[model samples]
Structures are given as C-alpha cells and as structure tokens.
Target: TGACLEKKRAHDREIHLHEQVEKNYARLQELEGQRDGLTYMIVHDLRTPLCSLISGLQTLPAMGELGADQCEVLEIALAGGETLLGMVNSLLDVEKMESGAMKLDYTLLDASELITCAISQVSDLVLAGDLTLVRALDSDLPFFEGDEDKLRRTLVNLLGNAIKFTPAGGTITAAAHAGEDKQSLIFSVSDTGEGIPEEDFERIFDKFGQVSSRQGGRLMSTGLGLTFCKLAVEAHGGKISASNAPGQGSTLSFNVPIKPVQTIAV
Candidate 1:
C-alpha cells in the first residue's frame, strides 16, 4: 500500500507539470500574436499620412509665390518630411527582416564603391553640421558576398550618428580592412567628439536605450538608429560593438565574413 501511494503521488505531480507547461505555451502564443498584430497595424497606418505629407510638401517648392524666408522654411519642412518618410521606411524594412520576409541578394560587393555611395548620401548633412568626413579603404580588401542595400543602410546610419553627435570642427573617419587569414572585412567608424561614458557603452546598443545623460539628452533623437544597426548586423551574422576613443569621441566597429555565407542566403 505504501509503494502504491508513492507511485500515485508521482503520477499526480507529472500531470500537474504538464498542465502548467500547456498554460505557459498558450500564454506565449497569445502574446506573440498580439505583438504581430500591433506591428502590422502601426506600419499600415503610418503609410497613408506619410504619403500625404511628403506629397504636399514636395509641391510647395513648385509654387513661386513664396518669399526667400518662406521658401527656406518650406525647405526645412520638406526636409523634415523626408526624414520622417525615411524613418517609417526603415521601420518597415526592419520588421520585414525580423519576420524573415526580406529577400537578400548576395553578390560580391565592392567595398570602395559601397563606401563612396553611402558617404555621398549623407555628405550634405555632415558638411552642414560642420564635421569633416574622412575615409580610408584598404585597396586590397577582398570582395565579400552580402546584400548591398542593407550594408548601405548600416553604413549610412553609422555615419549619420557620427555627424549628428559631433560638434563643429569635429572629424568623422571610416576605415576598412580585410583580414589576412580569417576572410573577414572589418570596418570602423570613429568620431572626434564627446565620448560615451564607460557605463553607458553597452546600454546604448539596446533597443530604445538612450545615452543622453552621458552624451547629451533626448532632444536630439528618437534612439532607434543604433537599435536598427544592431538588428541589421545580426541578420548578416556579424558582430558589432562600440568603444570610447582614448581622448574624445567613440568608435563603433563591426565585421562581415569575407567569404560567402553558406548557411544563410543573405
């Protein structure tokens, strides 16, 4: 009788454990479904207004009745519109990638060419911010297989952050080097501006995490760029990190495997 009672108790415990597991699994599925629905709704709703705003702002320049000051204000408004559109597009692209919906075309991308185009895209902003841009691409760097558009966005985000944070007369430098044996390409973006404090270095890479108290404040950004960078790099199966320069500013570096990524298509 004693042995039978013990066996019964063990069976009851196993059944209770199975019931708890089922409950937790159901909760997880419900939460995931809610998250997916929210993302879809937000992205869908953003496009309509974004299109209207950009279209109306674009038409303003064609009207010649405005004064110089008015035209300048219009230009600023249009610029803000473009920035918003870009942000929305970026968010959607990130969602697609996260959902495994983005198809990446893997091709041998010329590092030099990619860097030049990405830099040109943001050259105006850097110049307007009074920051000097510099690039040093190792000629011997081997061609690597990756998605060109994604890499371009990654580089642009890095350079844009550098320009935005660095004060007047600061310098932003980008360097690329190919590993001799590991078949990896290492790229680093360094800025000669206010450096991030030691404690906030890792925190800044976290999603929606801001280093404002140490670097500046929330007035300048929405804090999404770095998070996007982190996600893009991970999608490419690469690692990224940030470190403070000895005297001033910070360096954000990441590497891509030089050889073809066999397991993943992108």
Candidate 2:
C-alpha cells in the first residue's frame, strides 16, 4: 500500500506541474491580449490629430497672408502633417497585422518595376534632402508572387528612413537581386547616414523603439517604420534584418521567396 501511495503522489505532482504550466500560458495570453487592445486604442486615437493636422496644412497654403516666412512655416506644417499621417498609418497597419486581419493579395510582379515606382513616390523627399538615390536592380530578376502593396510599403519605409537620416550630401541606394539559391529575391536599402549602434540594432525593430543616439534626436522617426517593415516582410513569408554598413551608414535588407504564380488575365 505504501508503494501504491508513492505512485499516486508522483502522478499528482506531475499533474500539478502540467497545471502550473497551463496556468502560466493562459496568463501570458491574457497579458498579450490586453497589450494588443491598448495598442489598438492608442492607434485609433492618433487618427484624429493626424487628420486635423493634414487638413489644417492643406488650408494653410490658401491663407491670404502667406509670405516667404509664412511659406516656410507652411512647409514645416506640411512636412509634419505627412509625418503624422505616415505614423498613424503605420500603427494601424501593424495593429491590423497583429490581429491577423491583414490579407495578402498575391500577384506576379516585376521587382524592378515595383522598386522604380516606390522610389518615385518618395523622390520628392530624397531630392529635397539633396541625397543621391540609386537603384541596382538585376535586369534578369524574375517575377515573384507576393503582395505588391505591402512590399512597396516596406521598401518605402526603409528608403524614407534612409533619406531622412542621411546628411544632405549622403547617398541612398536600393538594390535587388536573386538570392544565392535563386529561390528568393534579396533586396536592400543602404544609406550613408548615421549608423545604428550595435546594442540597439534589434531593439530598433521593436514597437515604439527608436534610435535615439543619432545626432539629431528623433529627427526622422515616428518609431514605427522598422517595426512595420518587420511585420510586412514576415507577412509575406520573408526575412528582414538590419546592420551597420561597412562605412558610415546602415543597411536594411529582406529576402522574399520567389515562387511563381499563374498570371491571371482580365
């Protein structure tokens, strides 16, 4: 009877251990759900001011008293509006992704064409900063199946950050090529800007994490660009990473699988 009791106690202990692990897991899920809820609320709240600022800036240009000084202020206002709008959009996009609501509409796309269009969208900012933008896309790069919109957004965020952080005379380059195995497309955005600190490299991809050590404090950060890039790349079954370039800048790169899909005719 003593041996039987020992076995019963051992079984009870194992069951208790399993119960404890389950309880901890449940608690973790609860905490994560709460965090996501708070994030959604905060992102939703930002939309109001973002819209208001954008609208106010649109009205500023029409004000009758606009002089050179006023024009400068208006320009600043316009830039701020753009920044706020971008931040709100990034936050909402990430929140949607986290909630599993972001749907990827994959289509066969020419990588070179996509990069060209994305760069054009941000050409004004790059030119305004007097930074040279270059593209080194492979002419023979094959088409890949993916969500073009999200991929373009990820590239834009990377390029925008590159342009924003780089000095006026610095260079920003976007390059794409076939991966070593030719089964994936490897793309990178490099800028001759203030490099990222070694310790903050990974943290920079975390939500609300920004590179604060740069000369200009938060000069070009809403703190969501890299985070959004991480999410967007992962959503498309890709890998994204960042490292200090050989010289005076940072390089952000990602690899998306190059699976071909049948072309659908309209």
Candidate 3:
C-alpha cells in the first residue's frame, strides 16, 4: 500500500510539471507576437524622419554648385526618397483614419479646381507613362463644400494609380459632372490599364485590401491609398465606388453633396 501511494504522488508531480510547461510556452508565444507587432510599428514610424532627411538632401543641390553627374545622382536619390516618404505617410494616414484621429478642414470650394490640381501633381507621371490625358470636367459644374486638401489627395491617389496602370499610348480621363439629384458633384478617374477583377470591387476599398499596380499582378501593396480615398469621401458624407468595363479599363469615383451637410468658412 505504501509503494502504491508513492507512485500516485509521483504521477501527480509529473502532471503538474507538464501543465506548467504548457503555460510558459503560451506566454512565450504571446510575447513573440507582441514583439512582431512592435517591430512593424517601428518600421512604419521610421518614414517621417527619413522623409525629413530626404527633404534636407533635396535642398543641398540648390544650395551649392555641383558637377552635372553629381546633381543627377542626387536628383535620383531624392526622387526615390520622396516615393518612400509617400508610402510611409500613406500608412500613417491609414492608422489615423482608422483610429478616428483625423479631422477634415472643410470649406466651400470649386471642385474642378481640385481635380486640376490633382492632375497637375501627376502631370510628370502621365508624361513618364507616355499616356494621353483627357479632361472633361463639366463647365457648368456647381461649387461644392469639401476639404480641398483631402479631395486633392484623393484625386492624386486615383490619378497616380491610373497613370501607373495605363500602358504607354493609353489614355486617362478625369471627368466630373452633377449627380442625378443635381445637388451633388460626381468625379471619376478612369484609366486604360489592367482593369480590376469583378470579384475585387468591394474588397479594393478595404484596409490593406488587394491592390495591384497598373502593371498588373500583385505588387507589395500597403493598401492605404484607396482606403484613404474612401475615408476622405465618407468624411464629407459622400460615397465612393469602383467598377471596370469589359476590355475598357477601370474607373474609381466619388460623389459629394453640392454643399456638405457641415461646412466652415476658410
């Protein structure tokens, strides 16, 4: 009886040790997950400082005379830096929007002007892509209330994608008109590049959603660009949508009321 009692005690001890080991293993997994998340956050936050560095580097060329080759190298570096900064800012902006930390500076403005400004920012991109630009903004379009800066960014994002996706010799159109109700303005950026698949229509607007370059196939997508557009439009109490026509191309558009429900004078 004594020997049997001793064996039972030994078995209980082994079971306790096994349970403790499992608990420690789970805790280690949790810590590793936290570490990964922290690392991702650190990498994203690094963009702001890098952008500032690139901006500083950009001024160096203008500050002093340099050899033509040196200047060219500096320019190339600056351009790449600017692109990196853009991605970082895009990711940070997504975080801000998701956390409800963004506030719009709404004002009464001409919406077409926003479109034109957006096109101007990407004019070089269009030229680089060897794509033709077609502008058909309605002349009689009425003024609308919106955040000019946000709307400008939205147009830039759409036009940028259009330019990236459209092939050489293809055309991109920036068109706007009055909505069916005549109380809202509708804007679209259509590109004759690799069009989006029908199944991705809804998913494209999601956070970190599937986004491909105009070159097609899946590239590394932070998915913040279109998500930013959707949020900006909704902030104005507007709706955004996406669609692709058969063998034509893809069109991304948004509609905002002629007068936003809430507006402030600038």
Q: Could you tell me how far off, in angstroms, the CA of residue 135 lies in candidate 3 after the best superposition? A: 0.8
Prediction RMSDs, each to the true structure: 3.3, 4.7, 7.5
The Cα error of candidate 3 at residue 30, in Å, is: 12
- The global C-alpha lDDT for each of the candidates, from Candidate 1 onward, is 0.80, 0.85, 0.82
Best by lDDT: 2
Candidate 1 residue-wise lDDT, 1-266, digit = tens: 99999999999999999999999999999999799779867976898998898898788767768889998998898888888877777777766766677776678898888889889999999889988899988878878888888888888988888887788999999888986656788888889877766777777766556675353454234266777777777777788889997777988888888765566643
Predicted candidate 2 versus true structure: per-residue lDDT over 132-228, tens digit per residue: 9999988899999888998998899889879877889999999999999999999999999878878777887888786665675552343888888
In candidate 1, which residue ranges exceed 4 Å CA deviation? 1-29, 215-222
lDDT, candidate 3, 6-63, per-residue tens: 9999999999999999999999999986965675598687977897889798789689
TM-score for candidate 1, please give it: 0.83
User: On TM-score, who's better, 1 or 2?
Assistant: 1
What are the models' TM-scores? 0.83, 0.78, 0.78
Off by over 4 Å in 3: 1-48, 211-222, 262-266
Question: What residue pairs clash in candidate 2, if any at all?
Answer: none
Compute the lDDT of residue 142 as modeled in candidate 3.
Answer: 85
Tell me model 1's lDDT, rounded to 2 decimals: 0.80
